[model samples]
Target: MPSLRVLNHAFRAWRRNRAWAKHEPETPFLADLLSGAPTCLHVGASDGRHSYVMTQVAPKAVIYAFEPSAFAFEVLKLGIAWHRMGKQVTAIHAAVADKPGELMLVTPKKSSGRMGRAYAYVAETKPNGPARPDLEDTGMETQMTPVVTLDAFCADHAIDRVDFIRMDIEGAEQRALEGAALILDRDHPHVLLEIHPPMLQARFGGSGEAVVDLFLKRGYRMFALDGVRLEERTTLVADLPWKDYFFIHPSRAARLPDGVFKARMAA
Candidate 1:
């Protein structure tokens, strides 16, 4: 049996953590959008932790969180329930791919809260001892799960429009965009995409520049968070040599400061 005081302390800790999950870093980009209380679609929502913030920012906004991993699905469901956001947030057990159908999604058994077949992280190489000492030492197994395209899922669910979209589908950003052609062309939702150029090139035979071209052709501008100015010459470099970068659409360019969107290309 736990003491009453101990139980109360534990409850308080839980509440604090839950609050932290919904509000941390205080992103200026999101803060600007929250003013509109816009509906959001969160792709690659690992456990609904970040999605929880959408609810706090836009109390009336409906949030759709898409995730496919079984373990992550369970965690997201519990997180939604724990946060008591059943009405405000929805958890979709699906992966955002290039088409609207079932596909195998490779999920690593040991993930650092982010892993996907679409985005393959480079294996740390070690000095040659055996045929492949790294492979033998790490022994990481990839888990496959069912995946579907974002467009198909949205059409099936009758979600015609979303005010904001946040995608962090590992390295599947390009394919996910391809699947969301209709939404991109018609609704033109404000998009926040996480780009993993190295993974994109190594796995999909596509380059980050190609992905940027696709969005730019579709009337989207790019931006970097943390108040960095976007310039035509300024490339999207990962914080670390091989990390990830964020891109924003042009229509929502105003949400970011003048320094962020570079020189505002025609939307």
Candidate 2:
């Protein structure tokens, strides 16, 4: 049984997630991408909320769920099993980074402001950018978690093509991308990332600009998608905080409807 504090924290996190779900609901471009995508990747997938949603939104899609938290991974597993979605979703308990090795991760309980966000920062961040003020002490001790690279994992699993990838792995986004060069170069899968400057600073020792560069360097056109209107971005600014950004691999841009990547016109 979980402790009272853990249970209470979970309840609060769920409440915040529900509110965000109501406000942000999934977008159409995502629907289009998932419609026929044979495979999808969901990193930092906590409790399978989005995974379950994806199974419905993209009935033909096979989703990969990666989470580093043991407590959360168990819940995520249970959720997938409860929904009878074993065939469509596969869960892994590893953190993806620029290299394959072990690293210490500092995890804060799901107690973030704005929308109950939890964060796991790499203990030793060779960040590409400067650090910002710590959001909070978090006070949680560091835990050893297995680290894997996207490129290596794909090779080992023999996954030739990937259609879409949604990542929100705290702040190790850059490192994860850094390790996925081969896959991106070959498939150019649509990459959706959640960017948090403070978290990036705290964890990766880098900035959002660095995160964006990881894709742009590999021939991807990136856009900020959290706004009511989607806009292409050369880089991310810490002052201009954004949640989700989409990167299209040039080849699939014409296939998607404009509205999925365009601004919503007032009715």
| Local accuracy by lDDT, each model | 0.61, 0.69
What candidate 2 gets wrong by more than 4 Å, as runs, is 1-29, 109-117, 125-134, 237-242, 257-259, 262-267
Reference-based TM-score, model 1: 0.72
Model 1 misplaced stretches (Cα beyond 4 Å): 1-28, 109-137, 226-234, 238-267
In model 2, which residue pairs have backbone atoms overlapping below 3 Å?
127-205, 129-206
lDDT string for model 1 (90-161, tens) is: 988877777665554543322344333223222222222321211222223334456677677778889877
Model 2 Cα lDDT, one tens digit per residue, 68-179: 7766676676667656789999999887888988887665433342222355556563333222234443235456778888888888988888878888876678778888
